[model samples]
Target: MRTASWGRQAGGYAAVVTVAETAGLTWEKDDRPLRGVPGAVRRDHGDLVKELRDLVKRVGVQLGTLTRALEGGFTVDTVHPYGWWRAELAGHPLARAVVRRLIWEIEVTPGQWRPVLPEAEHLPDAPDDALVRLWHPIRSDPGTVRAWRDLLTERRIQQAFREIYLLTPAEEDTRVHSNRFGHLVHHRRMFALFRARGWASGLLGPWDGSDEDEAVRTLAAGAWQVRFFHARADWAGDHELATTGQVRFARRLEGTWREVPLAEVPPLVFSEAMRDVDLFVGVTSIAADPDWTDRGPERAYWELAGFAELTESAEARREALQRILPRLEIANRCSLDGRFVVVRGDLATYKIHIGSADILMEPDNAYLCIVPSRRKSDGQVFLPFEDDRLSLILSKAFLLASDTKITDESILTRIKRGA
Candidate 1:
């Protein structure tokens, strides 16, 4: 029933078909932009229709024109829902391209099976099986589930309770702003990761060289450097952690590295700490007293669970790192400062901050936060952070796209956005 064009051609499709799928009813919010959220679950069509109407009014444009604008240039906010949305601005080719990719993501794949609820009166107070089903499709893919892990590094630094990234945009700022307290406090987690390794055996006990083993060794031996930043401005005071900063380090101490206290470790040692690793798991705790508690041993022992070495010789970890890096790439538009990174493949297209964050473990799970330079649509204008909007937008966008259309637009939009 649909006519195909060059833009709509199936050959343009590229996103990997996920091996796993989620179950449940998917739904669209009855709001514009926000309504764009999608997932593998069933949702109400009326909600999407209401969303389309609201979006038309919000942007002061006709529905078709708005759709065209989005078709031309928009970003995918949801995947499973396959709902397409855009700001509805006139002929902006760049924006149009984004829309096309969004559209592509929606099309060229299996569509959701569940229908939307007709009214709020019928809505259940608790999240229902439909909601759970919606999450299942997303949950099925191990890679997709683990994609957000990189965000934890940022949280580790922000745990210090300061908007550190806003204070220093460049590494050079460290010297000018150097109050011994600010420097130490801002980088408390990095110091912890460096210090923790010396106590690795004591806390973790013996380098068995498991995955976590190599990870600990790489840090303890100073073979890796922590890079990334945590922007404090993005903190709403609601989230304890925010943003990740990364720096790669050169390896020197291969055989044995010793632990040193905060007082014993010199300031410039951070530069030396920069070595082989792609990311620095920012440290949250500092060895102010050089004392470890029963809790410390348990925490340290658990932290080493994902341990793995960083030698360039093995291809398996390299493959894992390859997978890990793409996920890390998600921070493209997200910021601890509430600035969004324009998600694009060309690293050169982005003006990024070279920094790192430490990873922290909660009783149940671990998380990260990072601080990086804000990328504008053009890499010139700096946008302020909007945590709620950004996170929800990306989450929805991921859910809307089928693996086949995650990167293509026209095809995705044609199927998702309708007459």
Candidate 2:
């Protein structure tokens, strides 16, 4: 009396369906003359019923194997067997139909494992609301979700690249290749560069021939690339001067430099060259904002003050500060020197002499400091405020402070009362 919903096969295509139990088994085919005849009454019904029972048994075994695979911990290697089984099952009309009716979802965890139920909602550390909203549809039709997950994975990889390296809108648009192998190669190179820079967390690759679905699942589970890009003058020594003599092009891989034909370079290699060129230009340029160079020390000092102001009690503020201060870059760490704050940079340790209207630096005794500019131009003007490294440190400190405690207005109550 147990009913199992199986997929409906019409014109060789299996469509999803629901099932209900009945006292007698009946076989109904759209093209066949037989219509809902009870198995007990018809002689041919015996063979039909036996065939259906066998089909159901086979499907049940496949489903069980898939479930156990998920439970034991699914990985790229582990899923291969399941994937093969799924393919075999899908090739059989009855098995394919049965699988279409099965429900599966990814259990959101530090490990991306498939589960029989939507268990992400029950996990305390999981983003249940967001996962439910985004992953519900994917779970409903697990058999076909690989393509969707692959797209998601590709987007995440591209985002990781963008976070560390600046890309033009046009360059970003052009990065995706129609060729899957070419695209994979591009991601492989990107991951290698990311790892080399010490920006990778967790296992980044076996990218040369990895299954796309496994790659997607792995990235979704907290693996990340670093958020900074570098192009060294020494790294540029590999390329020949351009015919125009206006630019240089090179390729540096595994600490070895080589000249590559610019015109014949692969799309992936060309994209990498673009990143190096952009970084080189960005670092060597100056800024249009005359005041941009002198703004770093002021901004860094204010960021510290704003971070400290989040907690009301002096002791609480000190506790919150302990959590925030370590996020600062070693070079940008400021020390109170009587009335001034000292910031050590690569070239010099700047003693920032603060004033009501203008700030100044000593050793160089310069009114302004040179920093990198964010301006998009063939040529750049460097200024102190434009150095993304300093900005990132300050931003991290602010975020740490904001996340540590609630910023109550009670901290300013005493000052208002005095006024």
Candidate 3:
């Protein structure tokens, strides 16, 4: 074997050489420090050992704290270990490497750090089961998976409601209004069933008749008057049609009906009754809309009916509503009291009476209106309009107050302040 020398002169001058060459070894920049290495290598090795030991201890303590915090349930973010706890762990190199082994995505801000949870499209084979099963491939914690499933369900419900609302006819007198005939006929009958179930009687009002025709007769029996009109062109003797005719309201007063100018009828009655009519119109509109092939409203109706059938008593329904209401963005401004969700509005608050597939609103003693519009994002039956305007503004207000994105920032700030 050829011996390696520390000093080897290629020319006449003295050669300077490294210690590794003298030892018959070649050093590489990427080489790991070995035990018994002397001088600078020894110091580097010692320092590395101490640093690793310290890092291991720190990680152990942090993991223990995390385990304890998650003993109850896994949360996306924990308040106990300080806010941005995940961020803190990622700040250290070794600790970050350790944390990468755990499945977590840090949420930094809007448009940043949002974890892309598995979507329904991710698993082709899974149907309704996809929400819970898709995360298994990633080995997500059970609690996290459960939370994600709930979120998926919530989003689906919201989408269903949005579809229902969007497909509904916004203006009156369209051909679609004809579809409301059946719903209007069945309205009183449904109200009676709602009352029998111990729903808010005040909101539902009183049903004085047994059938649809009887109910209409009873409704028209009071000072309340209703009218219908037909516009027909006069036929000339020779076959030409006359063009001039005026629209009028036929009002029944003191058992005698008379045709009067449209202005004779109170404009308020027409406006209010139109809104009331729209409720039934909206329900019928859902099925008639071409986009409702998914049976969103029908499914929502069945689900509400099922919940009512399963729940035996008023108290049970109240309890169920309490659990379900918090998940709804619209319920934020509404306080639950027994069977009622008291919705607070700027001018006046209304009591939302929850029944099987129906939601009635008592804006005041004079009005006990059924909310005709199903929530377009979720299938929760909701009032479509309030005081002539769409009820969406109220829903938006509730959403603004309960927004999770906004709450996250507030929580992060509080955590940083150690509050």
Cα-lDDT of candidate 3: 0.32
lDDT of 3 by residue, 1-419 (tens): 11222432222222222211012222223233223323453344556434434544665566555433332122122222213333354333324333322323333343233233322222122222112110121234446644544553443311111101111242233312212222211233333433432222222222343111211211122333332211111221221111111112345677775544434444433332332333333333222122222334343433333223211122323443454556656665667754445665433444443322222234332222222332364445333112111233233334333433334554334323321
Per-residue lDDT tens digits for candidate 2, residues 72-122, read 221111232333434453233434433332333333553464543211122
Residue-level lDDT tens digits of model 1 in 194-298: 453331211121235311112233332243323222233122132122222333223344554443322333333332232212213312322111122234433
Pick the TM-score winner.
3
TM-score, per-candidate, Cα-based: 0.17, 0.18, 0.20
Give candidate 1's root-mean-square deviation (CA, Å): 24.9
C-alpha displacement of 45 in model 3, angstroms? 74
lDDT of each: 0.26, 0.30, 0.32
Candidate 2 ranges with C-alpha deviation above 4 Å: 1-159, 163-261, 288-419
For candidate 3, give the lDDT of residue 52. Answer: 39
- Where is model 2 poorest over a 10-residue stretch in terms of lDDT? 177-186
Which has the higher TM-score value, candidate number 1 or candidate number 3?
3
Candidate 2 matches the true fold with a TM-score of: 0.18
By the lDDT metric, which is better: model 2 or model 3?
Answer: 3
lDDT of 3 at 397: 32
